[model samples]
Structures are given as C-alpha cells and as structure tokens.
Target chain A: MAALDVAPAARRGRPGYDQNSMLEVIVEVFVDRGYDASSLDTIAKRLGLSKSAVYHHFTSKAEMLEIALERVLGELERVFDDAEALDLPAVERIRRIISEAVLVACARQQYLVLLLRLHGNSDVELNAMARRRELTARLSRIFEAARAEGGARDDIDPALAARLTFGLVNSLVEWYRPDGPDEPAALADTVLAFVRSGMLAADGRGPR
Target chain B: MAALDVAPAARRGRPGYDQNSMLEVIVEVFVDRGYDASSLDTIAKRLGLSKSAVYHHFTSKAEMLEIALERVLGELERVFDDAEALDLPAVERIRRIISEAVLVACARQQYLVLLLRLHGNSDVELNAMARRRELTARLSRIFEAARAEGGARDDIDPALAARLTFGLVNSLVEWYRPDGPDEPAALADTVLAFVRSGMLAADGRGPR
Candidate 1:
C-alpha cells in the first residue's frame, strides 16, 4: 500500500483519522462479513467513525468497494511490472510471476481475500472481474508462448493450465495464516518445486 | 445420502418432496448466497415447500445445514473407505485419494462448494470443520509415509504438503463447471499429470 500521507485538506471527519486507514478497517469488515451484509453503520461502528464521517469519505458502500478494489487491483497489477518480466525467457517470467504473486498476496492479505470472494454484484465488481479475467488471459498467452518456445509441456490445454495455476495461487487466500511456519519465500519455493518437478523425486536421483 | 426409502408414514408434507433432492436445492442457495443470508423461506420458495413443510423435514436452517453436510462429509469419507485406500502403497493411496476427490467433488458439486466455504458459524459447520481437519490429517500421514517409502519428496514440510495438496483438490469447487469441456475423468487425469509431473515437460526426455 502507498504511504498514508494524505494531505490534511483531504482528511474526512477527525483530524487524526485518514481515509486510507478507514478503508483498511472497512475492508476488514467486508472480509469478516460478506460485503452485502456489511453496512456503513457496521463499518463506522467498527472504526468508531460516525456514519456521516464515513459518508464524508466514501459516498456509499458501493463507492467504498470501488475505492478498495482500485487499491487491490493496483497491488496485483504490479506483478506484471516486475523488472524480470520483460527480459527473462517466457517460462522464467512466468515463474517470477508465480513467485511474486505469493509475496504480494501475503503483503496484501486482506485486500486479496476480498478480491477473490467477489461475485461481481455491482459495476465495480464487474470491472474487477474483467481486470482479473484480463490478467488470467495475459498468463494464458505466456503459457502458450512458453510451450511454443519448448520451455513447458503442452499436455494440459494452455487455457486450463492458466486456470489451474491461478487456482493454486489464489488458494493462498483460503488458508495462508500470516503466523504460519512457512514464510512467503519458502512457500513460494515449495510451490515452484512442485510445479517444476513432480512431487516424486527428480528423475533417477534417489529420494532424500 | 441416506437411502430414498423413508417409510411412507415418515414422509414430510407432500409425498413427492424428498429429503435428498430438497437438500440439493437448499445447498445451492447456500452456495449462491452465503449461508447466513440463506433463509428457510428462500429454500422453501425454491422447492415450493411451505415453510412448515420445510420444518417437517428440517427444524431450522441449522438443521438443514447439518443434514446437507452429512451427505457431503459422507461422500468425502467414502474416499478413505476405498479398498485401494488400505491396500495400495501409501503414495498410491494418496494419489488415488487426490484423483477420487476430484470425482467426488464433481459428483457432489453444490455440497462440496458449501463444504469448502464452511466458516464454522454453527455447530453443524464446526462439525464439518472437524471432519475436514481429520481428512487433512489422514492425508498428511499418507504423505509422511509416502516420503519415508521414497515415493514422494520430503523437501516440502509434510503438513504444508498436505495443505497445498488439498488446496489443489479443493480448488475444483471454484471453477469446475458441469458443462465444461473436460469430464471428471479427463480433469482427474490432467490433475494427476500435473501432480505426478509438473506442467513443464520431463527434465531429460525429449518432448512428446
């Protein structure tokens, strides 16, 4: 997330409270309670902000969703901007994307959790869904290119491969506890290991 | 699911309305609308069952959740009950479980979707959580034994391995459309192929 240096002029209700921090609390409620059931009153109560104060920042629950999704999409889009993306072999770039996704998800846990559960209930959600589909399509092209370059197998349909790959990546939202024993780096390596080599020992190398 | 032959005297309101099929419709609502938002009235309206008729079959939404979970948990448990689960090599058993899980998940799509999203909101959900944990522990033991026998790699922590393995299997709930191109059989083969061999072609052998 960007630094929380909102100019004082943009501040909403209280001098101490910032819009970003209020958004953080709101997203947390959205995560704990499904978005539809979450109300401005509930969000304001959680943050100790008055409902009118919340309105000072975001006009409606839908607006809050729009603002929160913008931040989440921004964080995710940075995956494609990694320096290695342009210079590496397509397969290598794909690996970098997978590895970085785990890190990004860990860093932006709450936002990503909300992103995954989205059902496209509103215009904002539909746009988020389109962005997600676009990202998946981008990965599919990379997978297809990797196959053409003879860097990957073609046994699985490239489209299906893209979907399953995202499935494994997004499943992080389901069970990744920040307090867990495995850190993002180690977990990424393990995921890469399973993706690069079958769970069985490397061919002809005896099991450890 | 229990046998369809409920004693005639035990039949709820309409002779035509049955528990298993009604449970199917109810579970779908739970999947579409998160469980808390799903009402007995909504379920009854879907089935054309009067509210009291729903009560005849289920005392409350919690009871409906309990009954539905029983079928889902039963379907999953039967995987471990497979003769192969006991007789095959531990790693083979693990592989068989992964393969069968996809089939069971596809067979019981609505129920499994509900099962995956379970949040332990009620005693029923808590029981489902316990059953799911038991399944995960069983798989971890299988993974540990499979590693000891040199049928699998030990590089990944066994418990982490169990979680990720289940994540991949359970992810089918997110995207496995019944109308999709791949049958459960084909998708199982694809999953097994990825699990047994990473999407990248073999390390040494020439590409097919």
Candidate 2:
C-alpha cells in the first residue's frame, strides 16, 4: 500500500488560497521548474503572499511535495478496490486495474509528474521512493497470482509483467491532460484493450 | 526520423580518452544528476579535467545532451530495418520491434535515460522532444497498418495503441540495468508475449 494512504498533513489554508489550490500551485511550480530549482520564495512570490503565509500551511517545501504526492498516492493506491475494479475475474482484473489507472492519471496528472520527477535527493524523497517500490511489489504479486491461476501469460517473469503493465498505466501521466479531447473512460478502455492484448493466455481469451 | 540521424558534431577526443568513452561519461553524468543539475564544472570535476578541458570537445551542456541522445536515436531509428526486425509477419513485426527496443535500451541505457529525463527547457530539449514525437508517429503508422491488415487489435485507435506499446517499451529507462541478470532477448520476449495476447483476433491467433 502507498505510505500516504491516510489524509496528508497541512490541510490548513489562508483566506483566498484553500488547501487544494495551494497544493496545486506547489505541485505546478515543482513541475514547471525542477523540484531542485523550486523554492519557498518562488511559491510565495507566485502566490503574492509572504513566506509566513505559505509557512502557515506547510512547514517545508518537502511537506508541499508530500501533500502533492498524497493525492496521487490515494488515487493509485486504491486501484484494486476502486469502483470499477471491484469483483473482476482474474483476467478481467488486469484490464480493470489498467482502466482505473488511466482515469487516476488523468485526474491527478500533476501529482504523478511530480512524483516521477523526484530524484530521491532528500529524506522525504527517499521515503517516497521506498513507498513507490512497495506499491510495485504489491503489483508484482497480483501478476504472480494471475499467472499462477492460468488467467494470464505465463511465459514472462511476473515482475517484468507487472512493470510493463504499470508502465502503460503510468506513462499516461506524461501525455493525458484532463481538458484534452480524450475522455478518461474511453482512454482507460483503449489502454486496457491494448495491454490486455498482451496479457491473455496462450490458448486465447480471458480465464473465463 | 530522428534529428540526430546524421553524425553528431564534435566527436574528437583526447588521447587515452576516445570519443566513445567521452560520450559515455557525459551521458552517465546527465543520467545521474539530470540535465539541469549537471553543470560544466561538475562534469569537469567528475572527469578529472578543467572546465576548459571539458569545453574542448563540446561548447555547452546542450551539446553534450545532443551528442548523448544521438546514440539512442541511432539505435531506435534502425529498429524497423535491423536484421531481426525485417521481413516479419504483421503480428511478429510487433514482437520484433518490441524486442529490438529492449536491446536498444540495454545497449544505450545512459543515453535513453538522459533523453527521457529532459524537460524541454532549452532548444536542444525542444528538438529532442520533437524528434521523439516524430518517431512515435512512425510507430503509429506501423500499428495502423497492422490493425488494418487484421494483424493487431482494431477496436482501439492505432495512435493510442502505439503510445501504450512504446510506453511499455520506453519505460525501461526507469529500470532494466544492463548488468542485471536478465538477458535482453528474454526480456523482449516476455514483453512481446504479454502484448501479443491482447492483440490476437477474436478466434485467438496471431496474423500467422
């Protein structure tokens, strides 16, 4: 599970800037300028507020990152239990997860970009990296189970299959824009269709 | 076609340090510290040379990036024509292209990492981004042909299929160390098998 499964800290926001808006601005700055280049001063100046105003909500830039990533963590960490993912067949489970993943990416694109852009440069980032590894390990087990049950391709290593599946799911963060012409549901459907093409059993068709 | 299709300028290297070795060093640094954090001074210090010495072969960090990306561009641009990729069945063509992509990733790990890490901050990066789009467009065409000929799935849009496939292929930069125990061929095979499953026709067979 993602480390930030619970609600993140720093929910307090000033009058005009609610916690969500502040979080968006913080992540946007981190995205536009590399995480290493963004600073408290930059955030404050962009917000037309004093450093104390920014500090009133979050103690450090690292905290801002944590807040930003928490959104994506919540969305991504719930992939297996999300509404569309509930009660799927083993083969269908793979498709449901990918489809749900695309929707999450579209909804939380900046958070995904920010998380991937980090370089594990600090304690917070190192922890974030470890959390990501944990999520991937959990995913690896699902692929293992699907293959073991004859619901998925057995030729490749489970770990590799997991990475390939997540790669297709996660790469959407790079190009999928919420306001873009493509709708999230259809995107999920298409992505699942393509990835499912590769994950089917050798004899053809889903486990059913 | 890739912008770096032609021989990259400035391959001259000092005695004891061939052009290939220098290129490796430059790309490794770019991969390790990222293009933004890697300064000329840092490269000089890492290479045990003066700033001017680092400058002797390349004028700026941008030039170093260009030179480094060229290696990967060359490998990828040739995937369609590489011995293993040529004269394959429509469905097998997809397999071969994915295989070639994995090998290219293994051989040019640093260069691939550097290319993916770019942020389009400078003209060099903007061009790199454009080149990547062009290559993806070419891959899109291949997917279109395959789907049209009933070699691949036709339900999803060809462009999205190409992106999903390449996303699986290109995300190798985040992992897949060359020194790792997994052989490139096996990795390619596993990836292709997974992808091919969902691409088969309703009756459950490839183009063959």
Candidate 3:
C-alpha cells in the first residue's frame, strides 16, 4: 500500500494517547492502507511512537484487528439482540434494527469499513465474516417473518432484501462524513425513509 | 497477500487464452489479492504463462488495471449516456439508468468490484473514481429533476438518494453469484421494485 499522506503535525502522538485512541488510529490506517499492507511498525510510525510503545497495548496486528472487529460486530449483535427481544411486530422490529444499525455504522464507520473489506485472509477475519453472515441471516429471518405477517412485500426474497438493505446502510461509510451537514440521526431518517417508502411519490404515478 | 487457492488442474492456462481471457484472469487476481499486492509475476504465474507472455499483452501491471477499470467504467458511462438521450420523464430516466447500471454491475461484477474498492492509490484509480463521481452526480441531478417533477418524493436529499440507490445496487458484488438462483434480470427486477416501492406492502400498514 502507498504510504498515507499524513501531515507532520498530525504525526506527533498526543500525550496520554490511550489504547482506544491507538486502536482508532490503527483502524484508520488499516482501512486507508489495506490491512495486509499495514504493519505495527508503520502504524507506530504514523502515531509517532516506537514499536514497543504500540506493542504495549496490543500483542499483534491481528489482535488489533480482532479488537476493532469486535467493537463493531458486538455493537451490531447487541442491536439485533435488543430488536429481537422487543414485543413489537416483526416489521417494527426490522425498522428498529435498521435504524440502530445505521447509527452504529455511522459511529463506528472506520471499523465497519475494515470489517466489510475483509476477505477472510486470517482466523480473525474469517471469524468476523462468519459473525457478519450470522447477522445477515438473522436479518433475513426477520424479513421472512415480516413477509409472513403481511407487513412486507412477499414478492422479494428475504435474503436478498436483507442484503440490499444492509448494503445501502453499509454504503454510508464510503461517503458519510461525520463532519458534513447530515447528522447521524437525520441520515438514519433518510435511510429509513428510503427503505420504508422508497423514492416514489405517494401517488405512485412514477415508472413501473 | 496470501496466494490464491488455485486448483492444480485450473493452474494450467487454457488453449488459445487470448487477450480477453488474459485480462479476465488478471482482473480476478487483482481483486482477490488486491491491486497493490498484485504484480505481473503473480498474474503470469496464476495464468500459467511466462512473464514475457503476460508482457506481450500489457506493458505493466498499471496498464492491466487501467484496462480492467475501463471495461466497467466505460460500460457504466454508456448506460448514463443512453439514459440521458431517452425522451422520457426524469423519473423514468432515473429508472433506466439504475436498471441498466444493475445489469452492468452484475455482468462485470469483478471489474465493478475493483472500481469500487479503489481509493485513489494511483492515477488510474483516481481517474476511475472521478468518472464514478461524475456518474453519481448525473444520477443525483436526475433525482433532483424527478423530485421537481413530483414523481419522486421531495423529502430526501437528491444526492443522498442517488448514493443509497446505487449503494444497494453496488452491494451485489459482495455476495451475488453468477451461478446462483437469481438471474441478472430477476435481480434487477427486485432491485427496481425495492427502489420504486420499498419493502412495505401496498397497504402501507407496516412500521413507521
């Protein structure tokens, strides 16, 4: 991977840069430079710290990856768990899950980007992919249940719907700038609006 | 990057593996191993050809990448160009662009995947990204026109809608299998159905 275009001022690691901050930088580097190309040495150099200082927090690059993946995956799984536990209708539960997921994805955009980019090169990546698949499967089941309950359209496949829904949600990481105009809540609202009613006017006079 | 798990039988180059076939293999390796990690040596080995044979078709790895990116980007640009020439309403034109884009994406899944994965690491990648942004901008303008025509809902931002629409469409690269059950036409239909009307039933009695 090409070296990151880091400014010299940004290279100076802030005093008391804790493990969480270090992991954030690590995830950012991993995303910018492909994980395979990124190393602890490069990461330390970016942070303006010695390799030993970086190693004080994490044992290996894979461990850092695991921690990052866990942070995002764990949050998503919790959203799923909480949504599934709700007494609301299946469709309502689906909405809750998607809305919460958009928020989680926005909040943990870098980690989510790394998680999405993984091609299962290592045990950590493979495990993360498995968890992601499980999450999708769980969402598919909810869609199936919603269809059976007549809350969702029956024509579309549940698995396809689940994938496409999350696909749109996940795409936010590619262009969503937290510093940009759209707040996370508003972004989630727009996403929910699109996923719920789509872009057509209520009159339904648009293209077939 | 870890070596691709090529079967022994598949390692041998097929008879008459011309430039088109060679480009296909080159793209496959590039996507699997990543563009930066991939090189002429690795690609030649994967194709069971000598480095000179690989060199006969392309000058360097960058040329191969440029050719692969052009295949997808060129097709998408054609789609946009054709859609713009249509004498239909803005909303209908938007539908045409998206449906054609989905078809292009499915047909050239690998090339499209590489295009989306690019982060401007090189001039070739930056050029492709610029063309992609232009395509998205065109789609966003169509959304704006559609909203003005009262065919699409005006509540959401036009640019955001365009991105989310294509986001769902582009997500096909992650999990779509050509040998899978859903045909490209059927997949496009489902996507169009979702984009036109969302997952909710026509009764609109589902989640808020």
Candidate 4:
C-alpha cells in the first residue's frame, strides 16, 4: 500500500510521467506519514530511485512539498479564474464552482489532503491560506450577488452560507473514494441538488 | 503554540492540574504536530514533568489519544442522553442537540480536531467511528419521528438530511474559535434558525 512498483516494460512507454510523477508519489507518502516524519530517503526508496536522483530534480524535501502544494494551488487558481470569467446566473456559477471543486479533490486526492491539513504556521501554509481566504471572499461576494438577484434566499447571511457551502464541498475529501462506490459526478450531483433544493422535494415545502 | 509549559509557581497554589490536565495539553500538541509525530517526552517537558512521571498515567502515547477521543465520545453520549430524556417535541430535541454540539466543540476544541482527523486505520479510531455512526443513526431516527409528526419535509431522504444536519454541526471544529468574535449560543441559534426556516422568511419557522 505504500508505492506501486512499476515493471521495466511499463516504464518504456510512459513519457510524461517523470519528475512531476515522482513528486506526486512523494506527496502521497507525505500525506500518509506526518510531513516532518517523512524522509527524502524513504521517498526515493518508494520511487526505486537513489536519494541523490530524487534530489536532482528538487533540492530538498521542503522543495518537493512546495512544488506539490503549488500544483494544487495553481489548479484551484485556474478554477477560480474560470469561475470569474463566466457570465452565467449566480446560482449556476456557484454550482459549477462546487462541481469543479469535487473534480479537483477527486483528481488530486493526496494534494487535497495536504492542502486541508495545513495549519498556516509554516510560510508555505501561510501563503496558501492567504490564497484560500481570497478565494473564499470571492465566493462570498458571489453568494451575496446571488441573494441580491433573488437566486437564493435573502434571509441567509452570505458569509455563513459561504462557510456552510465550503463545508459541504470540503467534506468530500473525507468520505469520497474515487475508486469505490459512486462515481464522482453522481456524488457531485447529489451535493448540488441538496444545496439548491434543500433536503425537501417541491411538494415537501409544506404550508409555505 | 505547541504545548503549555507547566511551571513550579503555578503548581503550588491551584492544587496542580492533574494528569487529565496534562493530557489536554498533550492533545493540543498532537492536533498540531499530528499523532505519530508527537512524542511523550515533549508532552512531559511541556508539563514540567519527567518522561517517567508522564508514563505513569498512560502506558503509551496511543493510550492518551484513546482517552482524548473517549472523552469526546463521552460528551456526545451525555448530550444525546439529555436530548432523549427531554419530553419536548422532536424538532425541539433536534435543536437542543445542535446547540449542545456547538457547546461541545467550543469547550473541547482540541479533542474535536483529533476526532475529525481520525483516519479509521487504528483500533481507537475504528471504535470512535462506530460510536459516531451510531450517533448519526440515532439522530436520523429523531428526524424520522419529526417528519412523521408533520413538522419536517416528508420527501427528504432522512439519511442524507441527517448527514447535512451533522455536517453543519461537525463543521464547527474546522473554524469556530472560542476566542473569536461570535458567541457560541448566538452562532448555534443562527445556524439552527437558518436551517429550520431556510433563507425564506415566509417559511416562518422559528428555532425550537
């Protein structure tokens, strides 16, 4: 369960998977063991490479961690950029943003775990936290706009709503297994429907 | 901050915070550095006790983790017991349960982080997870009873709704700070009110 050992025949056809691929494997190891406890030598052993070979691409373990985090942040920044460019209705934009979030979490499972566990005490975490806060503020503004447009209920506090919204999205990393049970799209859809319609069906709205 | 430094002066007057107090400090450190990375010697040094002295109460670090998790489980069980004994309506019981959750999260912040971070790989985590699942099932039963009494939306999937309900409750561990701006009761009220009435004022339901 540590690392998948690849055969020599499989390595010949694989071209794109190089330093980045090795780094991703190291990130998974970091997520398993506490980052401070995980060693570069262990990571190198997992990749069937010498420690110097691993260090050839990256200077140190900290550099590997930085590169992995940057990859995740870069993907999220791109998602935010795409969400910002869309001129669709506010609720639709939110739905798309959440869906994209699920996709990212599913695709980059270890990186997402690393991102969530950050305490902001380190320089890397602090920088990532700032970016995350900015992204959250952006989402908060969108929620407010949606409320203003009567796309969502006006009674809900936009800030609180945004927190709950992210909570729902973030919970995916805990229980969502890409290899098990439901497909990612279905899980995302279930979450989207719950968010939009509440837990009640149209007929279940009661006397109101 | 890693762990609190226990001093000689503080020990003389207040009858000294016991092993339980020291365990609380160690829990905070574990939450920060993670379980495997945190050492008993650091906990001992933080509390101004020798490592041998710290080892007297708990045989191993993992036992300390078990007790911390058990303490949280104990609180949840107590809250549920009180909620069950209350002869109020089902909706009122649910409200009380949610409010209790907020209080518990605020009071036991470090323990809550440990509970949330449990990976279910260890026996302690697996046991705690089983208790959690049972608690969720119990809450779902109350939700069913409430719906049967014609208060809740009948078309809702009780399990999914239960997940969302607890999702809102458990999420406080991620961000709610006791030292932060909002009061626990007020924040719980806001969440409960919004959840019950939703964003529409016309729905007209108030917190029970």
Candidate of highest TM-score: 3
**Whole-model lDDT values for every prediction:** 0.76, 0.71, 0.85, 0.72
* RMSD after CA superposition, every candidate: 6.6, 8.5, 6.3, 6.5
DockQ score, prediction 4: 0.24
List residue ranges in candidate 1 displaced over 4 A.
Answer: A1-15, A37-42, A50-52, A81-85, A203-208, B1-15, B39-42, B48-53, B83-85, B203-208
Model 2 in CAPRI terms: which quality?
acceptable
User: Residue-wise lDDT of candidate 4 within B141-170, one digit each (tens)?
Assistant: 888887877655675556656776777677
TM-score of 3: 0.90
**DockQ, candidate no. 1:** 0.30
lDDT of 2 at B158: 72
For all candidates, what are the clash counts?
Answer: 0, 7, 0, 0
DockQ of each: 0.30, 0.25, 0.42, 0.24
Best by lDDT: 3
Q: What order do candidates take by DockQ, descending?
A: 3, 1, 2, 4
Model 2: per-residue Cα lDDT over A48-123, one tens digit each: 7889999988888888888787778767778765633556555566666667677777777778888776677677
For residue B71, what is the lDDT in candidate 1? 87
**Candidate 4 lDDT over residue span A1-208, tens digit each:** 1122221232443333476677767886887664765788788777777888877788877777778888777777777788879898877788788788767766776787777777655687778778777777877888888887776677567877777777766766765566776576776776665565444323344312
lDDT of 1 by residue, B1-208 (tens): 9979765674445457667878888888888776766777888888776789888877688887888878878978888778243767777888788899989888888888777776555677888989998988888888888889877777876777788777777777777889977799888887877777677755465211
Give per-residue CA lDDT, model 3, range B85-170, as digits (tens): 98899989988888898899889999998998886767888899999999999999999999999878888889998989889899
Say which prediction, candidate 3 or candidate 4, comes out ahead on DockQ. 3
lDDT of 3 by residue, A133-189 (tens): 999999999999999998778888899999999998999998988789989888888
TM-score of each model, paired residue for residue: 0.85, 0.81, 0.90, 0.77
Q: After superposition, which runs of candidate 3 have C-alpha atoms over 4 Å from their true positions?
A: A1-15, A39-41, A204-208, B1-13, B39-41, B204-208
